[model samples]
Target chain A: MAGSNHTPIKPVHRARLDNIAVVLHRPHFPENIGAVARACKNMGIFHLIVVDPLDCDLTRILKMATHASEDVVANMEVYDDLAEALGPFNYIVGTTARRGSQRRTVMNPREVARELIPISQNNRIALLFGPENRGLANRELKLCHTLVTIPTSEFASLNLAQAVMIMLYEIFTASAEFPPDFVPRLASSFELEAMYDHLSRTLAKIHFINPENPEYWMMNIRRFFSRMQLRARDVKIIRGICRQIEWYCEERVERLLREAGVNRVDPEGDCEDRFFGGE
Target chain B: MAGSNHTPIKPVHRARLDNIAVVLHRPHFPENIGAVARACKNMGIFHLIVVDPLDCDLTRILKMATHASEDVVANMEVYDDLAEALGPFNYIVGTTARRGSQRRTVMNPREVARELIPISQNNRIALLFGPENRGLANRELKLCHTLVTIPTSEFASLNLAQAVMIMLYEIFTASAEFPPDFVPRLASSFELEAMYDHLSRTLAKIHFINPENPEYWMMNIRRFFSRMQLRARDVKIIRGICRQIEWYCEERVERLLREAGVNRVDPEGDCEDRFFGGE
Candidate 1:
């Protein structure tokens, strides 16, 4: 749009997509698996390797994956040993969403993709994923050649699936933007809006937060995440958190009612979940 | 090191060498899969699959892999449609190097691998890899259950095989260190470098400097990069900045000279570079 004619956008040297694999270690939730499958399908990365998970079944996972990515759901490789699962690649990069050790290298999603793509041209690349509750151990990270971490707020731990999607999407988009520096890498406003919806809902579910007088709660949570300036992948993770909370609450309520031996109607107190407030 | 209490670190999944298949998707290089095979062999995982690889040769890849890992290279599955390749996976996760749109969920490499082993126990799991130049596209990432990103540097990217090895090593280590809260999921020193690189290069490339020196005569540049306390990635990024500097100087020399390029090669003056400088 500027009056000046700019330099022609140069085509960057993008490595061809090659033998790429993702390994999941000891995952806890099935829904997360489904969501990850959907994420892989969205990014044209269909290889899903699940190593020694807490649960292994296509049942709940399939429902979570929806329909389009049933193929990924259909073909998953399971291995008992993490080493066995990873014995096929030469190079490895460990990823963490937050900062811990000073030994490993870190990058936001975009940079890792840019760096990994070129070297992967003639090799098999395997990206490892840990379980839902926690992430890779320091020992695990030590085994790999290079360590990586995603820049995020200290407390803004992204859901397992959301982390995957953001990193993959960034890499793919970065690579897809053929002419380097030509196409803007920033997400459209629409994408950000979808994320906001997910974030607001997720926050509502996690704590004993009451929207009626929810002052510092939202601000603190938003403040925490906002400090990170959450990107698209982050939003997806927040959405997953909502799903988890929704599931957890449902399960907790059912169990409590079952223990009570009757599904009594306690609307007055039940309607208001005073979880953390009582604490 | 601790002989009395130390046992050989156990593999997460010992290779059963049955009912498993490893597949590669349009692999441009052979070494990555070979490395994957090496990882597989390490933990007793012995199934290999390749999908639409530009070239499929074991020797080229096996060179870098360990002695026992050759099996991953031996058993390979090839396919055209990734969906078709991973049609049987009960769980799926896509590895990404970027943050995608807010559509898909994500996971770090550790979490994904952590979840994989158990999920694949009773089911067939498939780990998919994209081409070399560009990783799995956005469409591909969406295919799997979750998007997985192996943390890498903002500037110093990893090779495809390297990404695989890191994920596998985590899976292997995670098995033995099964403490509930033992998993260390946080950014490593490498991550800091990437962030620093981003900040530094953006400043340098944009020429946010006082160009009166006719050289790189500004001290803000040094102070800026120093203030960031760069990681390995930052170092690479600074190199990238240096690389881009020449191009930027050449292209915008005329324009910048009229505006600012009239300065010398020091963003900071020689006195400051040589000794204790100004604020």
Candidate 2:
């Protein structure tokens, strides 16, 4: 009976296959575009939107696509500005090849997915991909609600179609949850704000952060850590680091006085005695 | 009563975190290496090991690390070969950034995590992160039993840290599960394989694929499809497309014969007669 109970899991796999859009920006090669279309098809992602795509024949790329996925190439919409094109979607994330000083906050695809998928179910979801030559511009990324970068080696950027396939794959994998055991445990938006507070408070205590004009510092730190989709313990560990730093700093003044007076310290005795009681 | 029975989740979210090690074979950038450390720490991942990293220095790069995650940079390990370092682990995933021409099968991070996390809990897990310049060379990836890549955009390539964080996050997320009602459904491995086979065979039959000397065509198709990670119904729809193509092809041949003088009358009455006699 138990053996029979393990039914074939087809429906479980079909969750969230639709209601998703893959938008490409300024792709140069037609073949790569075709390949991405094919990849989308292969993955059950039919919505393909190309923003400022190069002047290339869809048929040529479609030729490269598998018969099943060619539909993606056949029915792709083209737009000029990414900001204007991706406006309808409730959630949008950009893919970056490397880290930028300005937009340092980047989260794993799974984390991005966990955060976005719930909202996607209710509203249209769009994932904007940049060019074959240069990735999404800083301006384009700013319009996005979130930013995600695939981890890779420093040199040798992945080819266009290949990049599309990878992100599509990540979306597929991150979205698929096993009903019996795998529940989504992503930090909600409010929790994210709380974590940000913890990070800022800790940074303030250390004096590493300027309280008066901490302009981009907090935003940058917030970008990186927030992108991490941190749980509560992660916040706690970060808080501990701040607490430990402050604790060490306060002890440092007493230790400096003891050392200046050439006081010999006891190894087996009190650490406080060495600092405050002239060693 | 059900609501009252629910208990608060404790903050010790350490079980899913692995002693993950990034074994790079000759990294080029000090920044990329630093970024990898940042990526690890951001995801609440702390272990980092580099094998023969090129032109390395942790002091200069640790500034890029945001918090206690800098410890990952501080405690980085450098090794000569993989086996010497990897002898301590049971689960291993090698990152492959370079596109493969020979049809090498690479699992996306989700599947790799599903396979690795359970085994790692029983043993120390070592994830292989290749050089920042050329990804895991094929030889390096061969050392790993399983190969994985982070999915990016169509023309996208990623830095080493991004890939590591994605993999680690997936593995970490899989282990952080709740009870029965929480998990969403995902397609099983068997269904994914079946879908792959069906898509491949159907594509072959269509004129879309060259019947002669089908070199990397099938492979490219498979590679693209493999990235899709299709759900069961997604596969079913694809299979349905294949069946429609077969049906259309049969009808098309019959119409061509009528034009060329084989049938002339254009048989149309009985469905069974139309099917068999169309030949």
Candidate 3:
């Protein structure tokens, strides 16, 4: 068995972890800093940024990091300002334990993880964790485009390293195995608007819609279709049906006028004027 | 508006949070213990347990905990053993950052939060956290009926206090506003089986089931029905339809046999035997 010549093949590179940076903003403890570095190593994330860190011992950081993650500790970057630290990254996510009335709704780690995969493909992403004592300052949080909160019991005071681990875990799990893309691209707003306009005019010409209360009924129809994530092809098909119906009804009206043998011009199918408040 | 006498009415008692305990096993630092207590207070959890903690300063714990969480720190209980600490609790959840081959798949915090709401209604539940150096021991993990791991990158190290806070935050958010219950109580397994037996016999009597491979078809039918969360009322209605179909078919068979003039002894019509394999 020892002499067996079987070699295990290395996994093909996905490089999801390569573009991610774990940024600890104003970390208080040296040991916490070391733990963050170890966690980054565990998750295959090499870049670590400690912003405006407290005066801490590198020995304490390395001790907690152990030999396995010493490479991460050795290559860690330090910055004086949050903006400078985040300048290289395109996508930024801030983690906070507290909620406020003015703050945007936060995504849970799992949701963020799945979302970051596509973002990480072409751009550098930063995951920001705040200090142990009070979490990120409001000014620092303002720089982030999105926020992530770990769901906890009523007492949401988690240690800094734990928060870092949760975020990394989610991103790793999401990146490791991608889910099948079942969601199709939806129609753009312009296409949907054109379809709606065609439908409204067709209905009015056929007198299926009441000109007096067209707004109310049209609004209801818009609501119904908006709920269905219609595709571009679906919008075009619907518009085509509306045009056919309009043509069919108008042709029938012209044939009926000719049978009557009247000299007057056929009734104008422009009942569309009534819908637009006699425009 | 200030002088108006419109005092807000408080919600009625739904003391789900009161029944939960956050247990920390052999927590290394005293400050983390204080932070966890503060988190419990933030989430409305009153009970806390620390098992054989490391020698640490209580002042540091309280100082970090602040004044609002003083009650949590003062009332914290210490235990030498995990089982003794969890004796009063009916449900146990252990938190781990690392997944092992021996460990079961862990629930993400949000999923656990929704699940725990109904559990916390009448049962005493505990959320257990491990020590700072390495997390929970395997022996301690064995005592848990369920495990929760914060999704992290390959590097899964998180600070103990942070882990506690994330867990508490989830429970708190889930408990703060209850989602409207849309799921009805499902029919018990026994009720469902009885309905299936009746249905199979009816199908056999009506000549819809093939005699040679009746089990193969019946198994597929059973699989379809098991997927639906049928209620007791739904089972009753389905059974009624099966009975009616059996009666109509049996009556039609008797009329046909009488006209054929070959019914000196009526065909005993034992369709049950075909379904039950000669029951």
Candidate 4:
């Protein structure tokens, strides 16, 4: 079945993920909603449902979602009732910390993940989340076939996004499905140093850094960047933003000087002096 | 070594716990600090370090802590530098989502827990949690002998408490040392149902539940109670509170009716009409 000179591409197990939906019931915060979307996108689960959400502002949700997971956010469905939202799913799992007589059986996330993986192949599965203040109501939870608790301490109140991420992580890991590796040719130490040096000088020229004590700020910036695990492309993108800012500052400073009727001092020359000369 | 008629209680492996400390670097919220304390107490790790914390309000921390883990909150130590905070510990395990050049080896929490369990027998161990806004700085991470990344999605920003709980969970479960079981003679279904019935009627007598649409409110309360996994003692306490509320409302209604120069209608009679009557 090979082509003339090329091997055929093997298809991934897309069906494993095709049937999973994450449902958030009465989520109060837009940021948590957005973070959930980002997490869903990360684990290759796309379908998202928000039942009677407190806020439906796209801009606010997009703020925490960043630009990467817009597709997940855009395709999200909202419903006024929890039962109506789960109508399409054949298997439903509700998340909760509390346990009661009615709750059939409670399984940790790992066990639930293993159970769901096989069922997910033939049926649509819905993972339900409740609001931040309280977890899934019994009326809402009565709809689910299973309950999964993220083994927690006596104080088991987890933040909403944290709960979403943990459940999705278990499900994704149990399926043994992974997104493509993120190794995109990371920036060399020398390259990263150069970027920081350039950024520091640009900030100094813009007076964003106080000339008197720039070392502390520069050190903090270096420390922050080092922990980011930035790739080569990320460094380049950051540098591009810095360069644009420098360019804006150079022209803006010159205009302000001219408007004030002061003699034009070379912006580039002054920047070089503050950057190389001071150092 | 038996003393008196009671069998002597055996001491647990407290030495393994003695050397361990959980350090929070530049924590911003008091509630998170409280939560970290609660998690530490739950896992039987008591030593806590806060390097340059933003807030140090004991009252606020205790508010979220619910009075159980107060010793942890009271005895927490604070320092200005991460290195100083970790000076007492010989084995430092830093928690981070981000990977860096200097992070010796990135192990998942479970792996880290297993590795640390043996070392903890002889050496002082510190598990570091970073600020909520940004995680541990590269400089702080460089001091760690090992790194733990709680398996997370690509958007791997977990809430401060969730990360702590997950790590402590791994370690606690790995150690096979459990705190006492939280399930303390859970109330039977019939007992819980009786408590809810009494509570609903009390709330109705107090006019807390709207007379117009009481079913929706009662259903919601029932749902809330079911999730609580109420213990027998918990049910008794709740019933007592409901009884008090009913007495207060009955006395207040009689006084109000007398002042209004209206014939006193039987409050319990009216309550029966509203509680059992409405239903």
lDDT of 1 by residue, B62-147 (tens): 76454545445655566777888788776555666666564566677657656766665675655555665677877786677667
Q: In model 3, where do residues sit more than 4 Å from their true spots?
A: A1-15, A42-44, A63-68, A95-114, A129-142, A147-159, A173-279, B1-15, B42-44, B63-68, B96-111, B131-139, B149-159, B173-279
Second chain only: TM-score per model? 0.52, 0.55, 0.58, 0.57
Question: Which window of 10 residues has the lowest lDDT sum in candidate 2 chain A?
Answer: A270-279
Calculate DockQ per candidate and list them: 0.01, 0.01, 0.10, 0.04
RMSD of each: 28.8, 31.9, 20.4, 28.2
Give the residue spans of candidate 1 off by over 4 A.
Answer: A1-15, A176-279, B1-279
Candidate 1 TM-score, true structure as reference? 0.33
DockQ of model 2, rounded to 2 decimals: 0.01
**Which candidate, 2 or 4, would have the higher TM-score against the true structure?**
4
Q: Give one digit per residue, the lDDT tens place, for model 2 in A80-184.
A: 877667756645677776665443446655566665555445455677788866788765665455777654432324455555655666666555344332323
Question: Per-residue lDDT for B168-266 in model 3, tens only?
Answer: 666766642544344344454456557767866655554345456655445544533432334566677557545533343344334333344324243
DockQ of 1: 0.01
State the TM-score for model 4. 0.52
lDDT string for model 3 (A1-279, tens) is 654558664443243788999999889999888877877876678899899999568899987777778889888899999899999999999999877633597888878888887788899999999888898888888889789887765557666776786677556656353323245567999998888888677555544455556566577557546646777766765565455444433333333333334332423423223222111
What TM-score would chain A of each candidate receive against the reference chain A? 0.57, 0.58, 0.58, 0.57
Better of 1 and 2 by lDDT: 2
Question: Model 2 residue B56 lDDT?
Answer: 81
